[model samples]
Target: MRYLFPTGKGYQRKWLGQDVLSGVVIAAVSIPISMGYAQIAGLPAVYGLYGSLLPVILFALLSTSPQFIFGVDAAPAAMIGGVLGGMGIAMGSAEAERVVPVLTFYVGVWLLLFALLRAGRVLRFVSTSVMGGFISGICCTIILMQLPKLMGGTAGTGELPELVRHLAGVQVHPLSLGLGAAALVILLAAKRLRPKFPMAIVVMGLGALATVLFDLPGHGVACLGAVEPGLPALHLPDWSAVSLTEGLGNSLPVAVVIMAETLLAESSFAMRDGYEIRDSQELLAFAAANLGAGMVGCCPVNGSVSRSSMNVQYRGKTQAVSLVAAAGMAAVLLWGSGLIRLLPVPVLTAIVISALLGAVEFDMAHRLLRADRKELAIFLAAFLGVLVLGTIYGVVIGVLLSFVDVIRRASQPSRELLGVISGQPGFYPLGRMSQAHPLEGVALYRFSGGLFFANIDRFQKDVENCVKPGIRAVIVDASGIVSVDLTSAERLVLLYRRLKEQGVRLYLTEHIGQVNDELRRFGAGELIEEGAVRRTLYAALEDCGAAEGEVKQWIPEEMRHAVPELLRQTQELEWAYGEEAQSKLDAMTGQVLQTLEETKPEQREQELEFLLERGRWQGVIDRDAILQHLEEHLAELSRLLERSEDAVLLELEQERERVTEALRRQHPEIASYLAAHREELEQRFQRKYPEAARHIHELRQRLHQLPEDETKEQR
Candidate 1:
């Protein structure tokens, strides 16, 4: 449906008048500028008009951005002429005319292929600094190339040094030099005073009138004489004459620069106007427009940022403005050729130079220099590449630098030692937060990027450092780790074993499902033992023996009466366990009665208010049943551990111990029973399974070492 339909689905009929007016205004503004750019591309001025006509219409109909006006922009035009000129082809030569259209056609083919491949996504890697440098370089080159014409001398070809040497040898014509000075002053004044004025059109009209009236040619003033006008004859490029290899080689940079400029304009305008641009669709638009340009005898076309800005500032609606602009160009082609031929060459040079002033963009360069040194280096490399080398090679160098930057960032991701704040639930990087408190005897380490081969060694070293003295446990906060490659996973397995051998338990906490699966595949559960994967950071902290703040048992106001009834039912259940359980319940209830009598009547009611207070209450349970359940569960887990291949057996065993303790809290009688038989069970289990019995004994000792205040608080 998107392919079948064009953009601007919300077009209104009332906007037609404004669209037409803006189109005519843009046409007036773009005509002189486009012709000037055509001169930059080493083509006859009429070719600029020809390039702007069909290409503008095609891009308007095809592009997702309604405000984007496609035509010859300074960067690609300068690039085309510079690259061809660097190959020793003179500007406006017959050979250049024959080769340029073929080169443009290849650019079109490349853009279409790029759209098909969805390669627009790669633009993300091209940093803004690199782009700024490339553009600044192009601006410098264009300004240098125009200097000879501005001084009434023939334009120089070759690199900057060669151009500079050639300029030093040329004799400046006084008449042409004076005319160029006047045109530049008028152009700058008009832009500074009134940006909305058609400065190019006004300058062109006055220059042509003055040249004819003053007989400027007789005075040594250079003029573009006898331009043949009219729409170019539509035809496909001659395949037999086209040099496929040379054409492809030259067109690659032009195609890349065009897409970069066009997409940047598309995105900038779309963002300001509150709309979304389909990048792939915009690339398709570029392909179609360049193909149209190739069909005409002209250089390639791309979105012009300056004219597009005018289109928006003038409040153009829909593609109608572009259609109207193209019609304006058509009118010029049909009747304005004679006027174009009469214009002075210096005036056109002045117009091109003035237009390119915006491209220098010093503010952006300064920002890059201040913000990041690496990005600034990329900017300079691109800039110097174009200035010292050529635009094509400059862009290539810039892109390569950008890729290196991306790899450097990925290979050295952030590693943090995390700590929790006093009352905050989430963890933070330790020293970064002033109020954050580190978990005692435990280290929470976080890796803030994908675990891949390039950085896996660094990841291992960082983890090994966490096993410092006094740190008994290490919890890897895997919340930010989105991906884990095979190499990194293997490193993790080895790191776990190393930590285990040093008596420092390692745990992975709060990761997505994929990391969990990867851990299992890497034998995290079996090789590192089952207790390694924890559902939450808090649970891992608890297992590591980190002290928590006070916890209160909550009962809602409406459910307060039900607590007494629950307590009564527990008393009856204790009798089912025979005399031992019954006797313990009898003593607990008797203590509660004695406390109630000792308290004043007023305070006794408040004490009985369970919802409003926090305390431990004795409850009844069958001790034998719970003990029997624990023994059965452990026996089954032991069998499964022996039979299973590389499973998290220790984790399962630890989970069993945790669950048994929770059961003890529920059945206080089971607490007594376990306390009485723990030593006997450990000694017996040690004879059968020494390793497993040692882990169980360690767990019991840790539980015993917990502060009595915390034990009562837990109860």
Candidate 2:
């Protein structure tokens, strides 16, 4: 199980049963709605049924998650509907029918290409706020569009004028309206009951039963009527209709929109349920499903969030559930597709209304309240754009806003002054602490972000902005800086010269080694005198003052407000065994220790590098020196430990808990890596010399046997 998804095997086995039941129930309830969606997409009702059948099978076969049921979904259906409606391609027309296959083919190919490109990881870059706003917009549009369809012909088709004309042509179908409302009510109840016991399936069944029992076909109620059943026809994706000048018109853009929605839906529903599949794979899955669906005269298809969620709720752990759903849907299309026509339209409408209840954006609204003003503006703007303009245009607008935000932030930059307070030890910016006292003269300013071309001038201006008269020196705390370019380095040289002329010394503190190497290579280091670059600000201050006074001032009276980088993550700071790093280290060390037990005078040489990726190896007062002093104290001890040779290295590792607890009393953020099998420790003590092993064992005992006199004096 750990190998499958980096966890235990138990969870996967458990969810398998849940997947099957969830798939079946969701498919049963979704059958009717799929047809309505197909109708909206300008496909024949049978095409929707065809889509529910074959595409589901293909999606199941290709998807990573058993529970991910891909078929015709509402957003893309409305998208297709709105696009074709604008194009004046009404249903039952030869032009519309011809274009439908082309659209589906286009949608399929694009999804396939996206899947091939492995675009799923891009989902991480999409903030939750953007997704929330996008979904809210989609829901708003969908609800408004469905209002007419539910009004029993009062709201069906046409613009304001055409709706008015249609209304005049057809009177109020009261029985149909009441039945639709009832379907909505029952559908909601079933979802509330449980995913497995679908109210929609039960309610729709009752509506059909009422039709048969009361002979509703004799009344004015509408029905799904007959749909033919068979295997899907083979299809070749068409680009013959595509124009170089105009491209494929609406299909190309619509296809992109559909693909985005499909991937997003699959990730949120399928991946959230622990489906270990790539985004691109799901994209290919959609492509295959749609291609197969289109060829068979089925509507275009994509991943279904509601159906997928139902499967997850039921504990469907694999793609097998999708296969089952497809089989069941196929049987329905083959056997009872015609009986669906006998069901009243009002019942169908009610089911749709109830299904839509699940689409409410209450969470989105709550999150929006927590968002900053800028993010809220973006969310609201996106919401309005989709509601008023349309889905495609709204996303474009949101993207545009995001780009502007990026440019705006880059153009305006910030810096910080890093310093330690008087009679205090640990370093921090004095400015940000509202009540904290500054150390009078000293300031350790940081250019917090990277030094790039866009912000170099602004950075320099802020450097000057921070520097005022009578300051002895301005320390450019290069600890926060990661990398520097030649342009910035040259500018730094000029600034260094200017500061020197003014009798204000410039010092580079806690410099990244590689960056200094780069500066040396570029000869930028020579522009500034060598002595000005100190190991740390304290040592720099002390070289100009008395060293004894500075050395005595190093220890802090209390803990710093902000912890150091290595200690920032509190869990990582813990001394617990069986941790990720510790486990890995343990495994590594156990292998070495096992070899060490029988090894001769083995001479081994390893070419290894420990690049200073974050911190400086050298400083005014090197922290590494402080760390080494702590390690030396740890190494010299008098007590001894007994070895149990037969025990697994893993079991033996847990004994470090006692020693770990003792260390925490002093350096509370210390991490014990006995399980982590730190190679350096073993190489130096356990392998290099026999006496080192004695030292480790003795120290383990010493930690538990701290001298009472020393402990009391320290307290």
Candidate 3:
């Protein structure tokens, strides 16, 4: 009950005026839009009005978000219209009226079932691409469906192509077409001029006035004739005319569309408004609203994104705005029936078309084209699927595409080839740091996603890609791994044994909390040595005989005071498992310190490089000292680059150009690989420095012509 009736603890008396005004404005907006959506759903305009009234009231009472408004949304309405249209039911017929409530009831039942089963979590599997595709497809289908009316004729049946064919053959009504065009232009202009303007009200008022003044109805314009309204009756669905089985089957698609659209809107609003709404709670609210709509003999309701946006714009403080909107809708139901009848059908269709213009996602297509081709394919497939097979089939295709994408992502989780940067605190991916290197004879790999049964072999292959014969040890950075299933554990066991057979030891570090227990249960201790699972990455490196260096040698005596004592302590300890290595490390540090004192300042850098090389060969050097030296080298390079036209820089640039030309001529494979991945480089650079990306492209173009210019001169 608490979940159903959200608390109004933060409600302020100061906000009542804003809330009431917003409610009235929202009510004014939703009335015409909802009625238009109802006409799209093959029901009477009164149903759209009734849907706005009671469903809005019920949902506002039961909603988790205080600002969210529920009513006739275009996507679900179009879906219902498409489904019923396919059933050969005539619009506004008694049979169509009967089917709507039954379908609404079935949709309500499905929403309730989803809420009870807590199936909203399944929504996560439906990616943004899928939803975007589904919505865009529905928008196109709705636009296509409404075109006949927009042209001043009866709505056509069948798929988009067939409808287009029918539209080609059908005679166009000149007067109605002009009226629709005028209304579309006015509505669009009003929206552009004042985005917050009560567009539907102004448009409907103008159309009604124009009908009266210009005698539009007498000129062959089809007005919404004789709307009988005064609030819908509360009653259970009469299942005698419609089969429950068929109704439920058809309602499934409608329910899916409603749930998807509602949750998407709800989540978006919640994020935008700085509040949290549980998905399960949202489903329950939807269930209650639709069930209320069904009881009132109206079409199913959903969270209206347009109305919600208005609610936010109007600064609606609480659910009171929805109730106020409901009040306005109720007033219209009793006294405004005549006004609705005065509205031209073409004008109403224009309203629908104008509203749908917002839903058609060209921007989404552009973004996907820039970011991901695979998702773009899915979007196009879902879009074309709808144009050919209808909304239900399109949704099915979109969902399937989303699932396939999920599988593709999981089965090929990105891996990081990790290495230590000279002065960095922790290990980073080698792909990110060019100057970093792995511990000698040790390969560190980090899988950047969850480990599961479906991706076990993928994990194995990723590990193998980083392995080479000379690698004496392999350390996996398990920091990113949150969970591990049994199959993945078994695969890891196999990888351990395989590496063992190759005389390479496998070590695991940064096991996520509780995953350590999971590893042990999988006999990880038996597969590797008892002490192989180290607490830290550096400890693992030392355990594998990779970190061989005295800590004191890495720190110059003067700068030792600036270095944190904890880092010094960490570097001093050779291995994690026992204290035995510490005594040996202390003795080594003493010997290195004695050698460093005998060395002069000028030869100190050279001596450190010698130690680093020796460590790489026979395994022991001051890793801290090598890191400090690498930092100095990086600083020196930065200074050199800052000189802009230093002789050294000029020579390096010339040599680089020579090497690039040589590679282009002699190693086309390498050149081709670079060319193929150039876009990837550009994308990364664009993300990091958007302003520089264009300049970089210009520079590359100029550089590419250098060889051509030389060739032209020679010729």
- Sort by TM-score, best first: 3, 1, 2
How big is the positional error of residue 273 in model 1, measured in Å on the Cα after superposition? 6.9
lDDT of 2: 0.57
Candidate 2 lDDT over residue span 1-715, tens digit each = 2112211234466665666676676667567667777787887776776787767777766665545567777767766777677767786465655667777776777677777777555554544455556656655555554555555652343233443455566656777767777677666666677655655556667888998888876877776657776645666534454343332456567667666665554544543355555666567677888778767765577666556655555556666677667777777766767676676666765655554456445466676678666666667776677666666676676567666656555556556665555665666666786534534444457766566566779877766765676566676666666667788788777877887787666776555555555555455765323345554555455543423466335435443223352232222111111123234333433433344334333321010011111222222112222222223223221011122221212122332334345435534444443223334444544554567466546654654465767434422
Instruction: Decide which is better by TM-score, 2 or 3.
Output: 3
667-701: candidate 3 lDDT, tens digit per residue: 43344443443344346447856665564455445
Q: Which 10-residue span in candidate 2 carries the lowest summed lDDT?
A: 604-613
lDDT of each candidate versus the true structure: 0.69, 0.57, 0.69
| Global Cα lDDT for candidate 1 | 0.69
| Residue 45 local lDDT, model 1 | 75
